[model samples]
Target: MDLKPLLNKLEHYRSEKPNKVFTMYLNTDPADPDQQGGKWRLQLKNGLNNFESYLQEDGDSDEKRNYWAVKEKVENFMNENEMNLKKSVIIFATGDDDVWFADILQMPVKTAFFWEEEPVLDQLKEMQETFPKTGIILTQKDQIKYIDADLGTVNETNVYELDLDTEDWRLHQGTHKADSNLGSGGGKTSKKDEFYERFEANRYRWYKSIAPKLDKAAKNHGWERIYLVGESDEVNDLESHMNKTIEDKINKNLLDHEETKVLEEVL
Candidate 1:
């Protein structure tokens, strides 16, 4: 899809009164060192690196270089670009306490998930009451899905599911297939095929049922931008496919499809 128009829109949004929005995907865990948390820190670092490069080329000579320094630089960049954090909406999807830092630092942020052990219903109620402006989402593995139905019609939420073959689906099952060829090869093939077909069919039905709800939620909440984080390769692939479908539909309708752009944190 042509992204120039979307880029222009984002530019306009950023310039038209400095509406700054920050979506921070946390990758660090305070308790686990061997988990994916460490890897997320690296991603954040890479974003910091990118920011540093931008600063060296276009920033002032006295720019700071420490952690807080980088944070200041980021804030400065937003200011320079006419992004107003107070007017912007910041979303965070985090599993650990790293998100608390942003709040502790008093950053203009609104968190989505903080990995609480509270019951889903309780959490939902609290979120609705406490963070009325933030969106409430449900995360399955790496895929982020919206699950708020009471606020609007079920048709408002957007659900997208990927249809995969037996082999692909099996990979996500986190199990190894037994060596059936040496034992019960004859009946296994047909059974496996049947299982896969059933699974794929069900997956499609569920996803199709859910996506529109998400779209409706976005509209009801007045969220101009939708961001997806921590999704798996399958979800990412599906998103890309959906974007193409959207682009095609928009083109057919004589409308413009704005490409979604992500600004990675530069280290």
Candidate 2:
């Protein structure tokens, strides 16, 4: 889900013929943390050994040297960043002109090897399709934060913001002057009620302004779920104006928070 950059790198590698390239796979389950030499480490060694043997069988001395060099690089990489057992790993490494490019994917993949230009991306593509994206929308007053999330990996795809106070509502004296005049006439309503009434009206306008844009964005990105966060009353106010399709995707528990704080609490 957060693999956009990785995919772009692979696309650029399609035409590259490096000194050597290897696609390595390991079933990381039953993890070997710190890579303190455990089952995963053993699997890593075996996978590389098998790949080297395959390359050496019909390869020249130069090919053999490139294979070992890449092997050493991969070993060093694993040492630096230990593999997680919960997710499978598929690594792609290629070296040319003393420069190397490696793409590592930690996801569920069938344990196999592919010595090719790019790592096989079929599993990732499938996962993306299976798990439609998620959106987190936080609406309050004149500010709204819209975030796109990739729930499969708990990644934030994109974030956007909208502010609707081009002309400050607080600077408007007419409404307040009207309130003062009403008070002089012995109006029974509390000052709090008048302020709240104005606030609610603004809420309606803000909600109406953002609903169509949010709906279009959700549909365009094929979002399967949405996390609406705000006071329950305001959440209802905004959602009331949203397209029904978007409304249907809301979670049972509409989250509560002001802005980005909900990101920490929800996901």
Candidate 3:
């Protein structure tokens, strides 16, 4: 959810009198008690109708027609995406389609509507303040996962697995792959001890090798904050190696968990 371009556009947008921009922030989260019994459906209906009624009384024919055009588009958008709704839906539109923006957001928003000459952006700016672009780095013994998120929704995920044979961290498209075993014939405890000792000895070097990669990713994705989650020692080691400032560190191994669960736990 890159907000820069949208914010810039909306900030500079202004219409001559009689042409209004319609802004809507609808809370459609099913988990909310206030939204029980599909209350958002009724809210949407009334909100649009209320605007139409107000326009009919005080606005000219062009303004009424403009409101109707935007209203129809808003209704159609909601109808098509209702099944895929997340916590909220936001829309900024105009009758002539000179400016239109709609998104289903994982973060909840206060329901509000406005018909004005310019887009209403106070809520959106507040949301950006609350849920800035963030990067979550999950590290284990030999694997690292990066979750890039904006406005509380994951935008991309990248996985890097250390190739023991080549002693290099290789980027993979998705999450966990088959673990590289330590020894074929050995007591489990003994093998685990050996692996731990070996990793502890070279952890700094391995983390240092990947520090630049994380820095690059942060810059590329414009991560406003970075979080490191793993074993305490591992997290500390990685943090020390990275040049980027870490917003927080959680001493929990979450590489095996699903991405959503990882976010819930660490975020």
lDDT (CA) for every model shown? 0.32, 0.56, 0.88
Model 3 scores worst on lDDT over the 10 consecutive residues at 174-183
The sequence of per-residue lDDT tens digits that candidate 3 reaches over residues 1-267 is 898889999999999757899999999999999999889999999999999998889959998888889999999999999899988999999999998899999888999999998999999999888788999998988888899988778888888877767778988765545465465565877887888898888889998998899999999999999999999988898899889999999988887888777777766
lDDT score for candidate 1 against the true structure: 0.32
Residue pairs whose backbone atoms clash in candidate 3: none
Those runs of model 3 whose alpha carbons end farther than 4 Å from true positions after fitting are 175-193
**lDDT value, residue 234 of candidate 2:** 68
Q: Which stretches of candidate 2 lie over 4 Å from their true place?
A: 1-20, 25-38, 83-86, 97-107, 131-134, 138-145, 154-203, 210-248, 254-267
What does the lDDT read for residue 234 in candidate 1?
26
Better of 2 and 3 by lDDT: 3
TM-scores for every candidate against the unseen true structure: 0.23, 0.55, 0.93
The TM-score of candidate 2 is 0.55
Q: Per-residue alpha-carbon lDDT of model 2 for 107-225, expressed as tens digits?
A: 34555666565566665566555544767776544444556655234343333333223522222211111112123444546654774576676777756776777787678756677
Of candidates 3 and 2, the better by TM-score: 3
